[model samples]
Target: MDEYPFTKLVIERNLTREEFAILMERLEKLNEQYEAQKEEGLIHFSSLLIHFAGMLTEKLEPDSTINALQREGFYPSLMNEFIRIIKQNNKG
Candidate 1:
């Protein structure tokens, strides 16, 4: 399976395992803040997600990046759920 995106960043930065753990801790706190503010909406969050997708497209071959994203699962699963919902609704 392709490495997780954050794992690639950790390897590139040569972060120690301890340092990566600390970074994960910080990410968790940031996630909490994101959840808290979600109802209020966040432009930067959407921008960051779009910017990351664009960066990946620029940095990797199309197939390689897609494999990595599929391993990550969130986007693929989200699309699958959306399709399922649409199909179910159309059956009514």
Candidate 2:
């Protein structure tokens, strides 16, 4: 978007053609990344960039944020539950 100068600045850098193309593509697609940023890899990365844009837009509508947080692709909570069960078994 002409509204943001990140694309302009990156293009002005010494990046190779492939890098520049990838950068432009990413900036162009950032809005589409909002759904999966918290998970990992491509989706999470895109989601993260979109999330950063939220600051410029001035709000993070809790529904989306909480949904991203709740996706169980990775899990500390699950491991915690397993540990709790192991401790209970040890105690028993």
lDDT by residue (tens digit), candidate 1, 8-43: 644655767776566446434544554555557742
Residue 83 CA error for candidate 2 (Å)?
39
Q: Which window of 10 residues has the lowest lDDT sum in candidate 1? A: 57-66
lDDT of 1: 0.46
Cα TM-score of candidate 2: 0.27
Model 2 Cα lDDT, one tens digit per residue, 1-92: 34433434334444566755654465345434433432344322323433433532222332332233224322334323333444565698
- Clash pairs, model 2 backbone: 37-44
Worst 10 residues of 2 by lDDT: 56-65
Question: How close is every model to the real structure, measured as TM-score?
Answer: 0.41, 0.27
Q: How well does candidate 1 match the true structure in TM-score terms?
A: 0.41
Best model per lDDT: 1
Q: Provide C-alpha RMSD values for all models, in order.
A: 9.0, 15.9
lDDT (Cα) of model 2? 0.38
RMSD of 1: 9.0
